[model samples]
Target: MTFGQQLLFFFSAVGAFNGLLLGIYLLFIKKLKYLPDFFLGLLLLMLSTRVGISVCMYFYPDLPRIIPHLGLSALFFTGPALYYYIRSSFQQNQFDVRNCRKVFGILTLILGAVGLLYLFFPVTWENYFGTFIYTAWSVFVFITVYQYYIFSKQKIVSHNKFVLPVLLSNVIIFLTYQLISTGWIQVYCAGGSLVFSFVLYANFLILFNKKYHQVAVKETNNRYSNKKISEEQADNFVSRLERLMETEELYKNANLKLSDLASRMNMSAHQLSQLLNDNLGKSFSIYINEYRINEACEKIENGSYLKIEEIGYEVGFNSKSTFFSTFKKIKNTTPLLYKQSQILTEPRFQSSNL
Candidate 1:
């Protein structure tokens, strides 16, 4: 009838539908670890609880209140769940059950106790918690963004194609939400003033689901079809190759080839080549040189007695020109420049001496 009523009905429909999708994801989707699944479950519960509260607020304002600010209470878990969900999605094997369960229990107790208290004494509570929860979530989000920034600057997060989309989605969700809340040109909700959390919620669900499937497919591929080298095995092999290259013994082997490294590791040349190209995200020549570049940088910084050329040769680089080019490509700077700029040196070598 009224604008507010129409807005309320619209949100109610979105809330119910989101709750249904979340329920399906939780009940049916198999996870690699309990933490991710647990976090997802909590996330869904929060969405459902918020939807219920919205319905009551819109239609039955006079009904006995069980949870004052149920929607706000749900917002409290949003940040923590989001953080854990992203982490678990990336690192399925390292997902710890105890820590995850403990965090979930603590949040549940805090929110559930507050909800029950509000139900019994609805007049005692206030709306200050809403702002508090948002501020807290903002802090969590910024921390993750900062970590990603560090990784990018260090060149550790090389796949900017994937990372950028994920980060952009989060930024969009954050900016859209703030705009909707502030009543500054609403681009999301159709009916009225109430911001549709469901849109952002669906965005997150899709993002996390994509990440989950990526990990799941990799894991499944590794388990089956021993005849063909799976994606996960290739990834694991590259990790092992990196670790092997870290050792002084391994780095000393100049003129090393894919077949040579494969022989050392007891793997076939085809497998190693495929692993380097597909999973490690580099060609064989580039991958090997990147490792050498890292080693050369370390040696140049710490072992001041060793000449740059000597260090480069020891790390499997054939010539000074090749070493310099590879180092620049991987580190985004020349070996000499990187050493002078990044490495910790004695005060005697400081710019003041110049």
Candidate 2:
């Protein structure tokens, strides 16, 4: 083989080894045990197996033909596994067997289709069919990337800086492999493996970092669970939480999250959520909005002379419609009507005082 081919082979081998190590660490060494971590491990395993086989097939062309078919089958899992990994990482839902089954079922269908095509068709026809399958996989990657983009904008999940870039790298690598027909497939494959290995290692370092572990440990301990707390304890906790909010005016932060508030109260997000739901009979949104709406009411009554929308922004409502709806819902009157009532009452108060 030429020097270029030798270089590709070396990179591919290194990538495969790195992937294997990362898969093991994700599956075993990572203590968080989140569903995303499991899916990520599966993704790495599939990637390593697929890349390793590709390299082996190139180096030793006489290998059994079935091996390549198996590698292609593994390719079908990459897109879906990555999609789920990102979704499960950002989402708060616990692992659901039904979701896992759905992903597995899609993968099974793809593999079965590819297997049947290989069995019945000529080699050239099988290659063509495999191309179509990979094209579909590329589409899957596109959709998953789009979903991640939308989710990031919603701010409902913690953003991982590496997830999007890693996913886009897959899309780019696959497109490069498909589009460049001048025997550059090996180059793209080798480069892709290198990139994937780098991302996996970086993610491993981030996940198992000392700071992250310490924070996770503290958060796990504080997380609100079924742990029994006395009624008095619950009340005291609520009082402290309320004082923190009132004194700090945390509700004024438009982007404030339950977790953020919980941290300020020196508790877990789940605990704060439970306290609001069980003790206060409100969700976090309602609790925060109550403070905001009350502040808006005072501004309106005092004739702050600001536009209603401006007042909404001042009180931490991100949008005008939300401010109007929340105010109406809680106060049972529009902001304008409330202001009018206050204006009418002020004259009566002055006359009575006179």
Q: Which candidate leads the pack in TM-score? A: 2
Q: Encode model 2's per-residue lDDT on 1-354: one tens digit a residue.
A: 899888878876887888878777887888843567787787777777777787787787899988876776777777778888777766533335597788689768867876786678856566675676577568778888888888778854442445665666566656654554335445554555555555556656765684686588666866646675567878998899889777757777676788778776767777778778887889999999999999998898888979988899888887889999999999999988988899899999999999
Instruction: Look at candidate 1 and tell me the lDDT of residue 305.
Output: 77
TM-score of each: 0.45, 0.54
Clashing pairs in 1: 66-119
State the local distance difference test value for candidate 1.
Answer: 0.61
The global Cα lDDT (0 to 1) of model 2 is: 0.74
Q: Which has the greatest lDDT? A: 2
| Lowest-sum lDDT 10-residue window in model 1 | 155-164
Please report how far candidate 2 places residue 149 from its true position, in Å: 1.6
Q: Tell me the spans in candidate 2 whose CA falls farther than 4 Å from its real position.
A: 1-8, 28-32, 94-96, 159-162, 172-176, 179-189, 198-354
Clashes of each: 1, 0
Error of 2 at 214 (Å): 8.3
